[model samples]
Target: MNPRITDHPAVPYERTRRVAFTFEGRTLHGYEGEPVATALHAAGVRVLSRSFKYHRPRGIGLTCGAPSCPNCQLTIDGQYGVPGCATPLRGGESVRRERAWPSADHDLFGVIDRFSPFIRAGFQFRLFRRSPRLAHLAERVMGLIAGGGREVTPDAIARAARPGLGERRTALAVVGAGVAGLAGALAAADAGLEVVLVDQGAEPGGALRAETAPVRTPDGGAAPGFALAAELAARAAAHPAIEVLTGSTALGWYEGGVLPVHTPSGVLTLRPARLLVATGDYDQPLLFPGNDRPGVMVAGAVQRLVNIDHVRPGSRAVVVTRDAYGYAVAAQLCAVGVEIAALVDPRPGERAGADAEASFPSGVAASGVPHLTGHRLREALGRRTVTGVVVEPQEGVDGRGRAVRLDCDVVVVSAGRRPAEELLLQRLYHGDITLDPGPGTALPDGVAVAGGAAGITDPAEALTTGADAGARLARWSPENPALPEISPYPLSPGQAGRPSSSGGTSE
Candidate 1:
């Protein structure tokens, strides 16, 4: 089925600029600037690749904004191990599935999944141990098979050749162009400090780009998240003190505050007086049997697909969540004409008693959709793609209850989110830094953490923390008057939970 949504409430989908690309030698068309994975999904191509060991079918778990898994890897333009979700469709590019023989859809190696119980971890080391020659031969064969037949073409060789990286120096360097990063950059820039904002997305705004819900403004009014993002992005772009870099990734933090960034043109190294990391968080996948199936996707990924790319994940979906975010996803899906089979909440309580339900969009509740509380996902049932799901009450929490089965093509999971703290962890090991609970990490001089990475999940708090950090680094007062007061509710589901001192959820 074609899953492209032409009419969306928050996002406008106009396939005006169509571009053609070849996937496994078959020409496929999609809109320019959208992710290749999104294009394929719109074309009803669910299976993107195969798992490395079991050869089980895999698709996009998380979208391009935050790629936490290797499910959507492919060989693009002779380069191996390319992330399909992150790679944009620029037209005439060659994309091929990796780790599968013959084809990703009909792979001969798929039989290996049936025999996974026998092939345990380190099985290769145990086989043919007595014969050294046999062991060596087996190693060679295994390497060849695992390589996925990556071609060493001129494109790959040229890409591998790296001259000296370009260099830049700034007073403040902010990673992640999301709300937090934008606020930090603007705060520092207004304080007369030169700022550099870097983000891996095609545009600024971070998670706000995919957000369709109206955010609570400081003036007690409401505005769409995307609109706010646009306003911030435009201001940053026009600001003389701030240099905005989109489609750029921060490679790592090294000695002497050296931050190497990978841009579309080439690698650029930055040496800034102060660094602010507001990298945000990643969607966590729920654990269950058949959880890795093609049609099972994270809630944020579905949001990016529907709101950003205007591509419907599936015709019908079963949303499994523990918080109000799941209901928000169901509401968006319904808005785009996707039938909601059920909204399953694993929390143990009556639906009325759950505080999370307060955040559920009123439109979804009025739509006569089933809200199954006190139930947890038991299994996502299907062979390759999700066909249905089996859910049951929490054994001890919900008492004795009957199991329920819901049929749907997609299983939307809004389990939780983990902070993106790779850069912060890197500093802890390489520099003089002390880890603390919540957003209170004892960072070295000139280094700071903000937003979700700092355990500030609330959007208003994120902005406050970011502005405070920027102003503090500038030797100015941490209290920035330009930032808005923190609201009790941010008007975003799953974003209302308060961060505890132990870095856990107080909610």
Candidate 2:
């Protein structure tokens, strides 16, 4: 038996209309205007979805603005591949879940379990070498099942939606409040169109709020991205034509420029004449054994936990990096009195920028993450939760890898960030965001890209870009600026490039 959706008098409720929805043919109830994830969470459905390759259990992350994570994919009515995070709920909607073939929880594909003894992480090449014919047969079977993955393609995702997206309007809607988004909104607003700017953070600033590293300003005044975000947010708020909806995210975008922004309050349908999407990216965590331990978190998630939420993800942590920005996060965290276990960079004396690398936290064990040239996280130690981490040499057998389990709960993985372009993928699918090598889709016809969307990686560039976006909306020529000398989305510390003479790199 499932708990019925009811408004407990013990807790004050918000909505008046009740909505009926279904998940995997299971009749469920939700509010008329609540996020599908929110309803699921409220109904004690913690395991909202699972991963593709491993078919691991996953649930809601901080927000449900995109389909990046595998947690929120379930079938609606007869629909599949719909991201429950980005998809909301409505009355009379039926959703059927596509659990793995046998079942969602206990899939027979556990045959991978039989091969674990012979194979380790990244062992496809090794397996092929041992038995070419057998390995070839297995590979063929894997491809037949897309390596045994789900059937949700990109097109199926675009056509999924909830309900109750009528009655509100926006001339121009910008779906991010970070540096790039702010710039885009200002530019669109100056063009004399009322704009709705939505962001998931409490402040309009996105990554800037979580980016704790110091940014070298033109005059040498050291300014962290957070500080620049603070200033830019104020200017954006002062704009009369721009409605700053902080703590709000474009839950999803629909036809006719209708974007429903969700906050703690509820979902608001903003009908924009144009959309300037600047939803920033997030550092992706690498998939390794025991990667889902409690202490293990994304570098960006830790930064937000420490700086914005005023909470530490762990008292002591290990940061695995091949990038300079990973060290930047380490320095910021150490300065905040958090104990550092080690700073493992997989790259060599890799120039982390003489000017910038000088800032990596001192007196800590900063070495390559790979100890024996190709070390990977082997097993996350703990019974109920994460108590330690064991990074071992790559390509080990069932028990061949050397393990170094550190006495720490938090393991911050700086894998790297991908553009939070899931929503943009919709346009790209509908042939909106073209595959153009330049300007990506003719700037979406009246939609101007600014900040990260326009490839602006610096806080300083964000300000200029945003101001320029506003000016461009008003028919001014503000040449799109170049990216910062330092990579804002740093994946490799040694991958630093000198900025163009103009002091940045633009697409």
Q: Write the per-residue lDDT of candidate 1 for residues 1-507, one digit (tens) a residue.
A: 458777687765567589999988799999999988888888888999988878889987633335356888888888888888888899998999888888889888889889999988878768877887887887777666665444688978797566656788888899998877888788889999999999988888887777766665445776676776777789899999999889888988988888998887778899987888878877777889999999899887888888888888999999887766666677788888999898887676564224334544354457677777777899999887889999988766763568989999999998767677777677677755665554435555566667777656555566666777777667632344333322121112133233222112100
- Model 2 residue runs over 4 Å out of place are 1-170, 187-193, 216-222, 251-255, 262-268, 352-357, 361-379, 392-403, 437-440, 454-456, 476-507
Q: How many steric clashes between backbone atoms does each model show?
A: 0, 20
What are the per-residue Cα lDDT tens digits for candidate 2 across 230-349? 766887899999888875667666666667776545667776655666665555566766676345666665565455433445567777755555666666666565677766544433
> Would you list the C-alpha lDDT of every candidate in the order shown?
0.75, 0.56
Best by lDDT: 1
TM-score of 1: 0.89
How far is 58's C-alpha from truth in model 1 (Å)?
0.6
| Residue pair clashes in candidate 1 | none
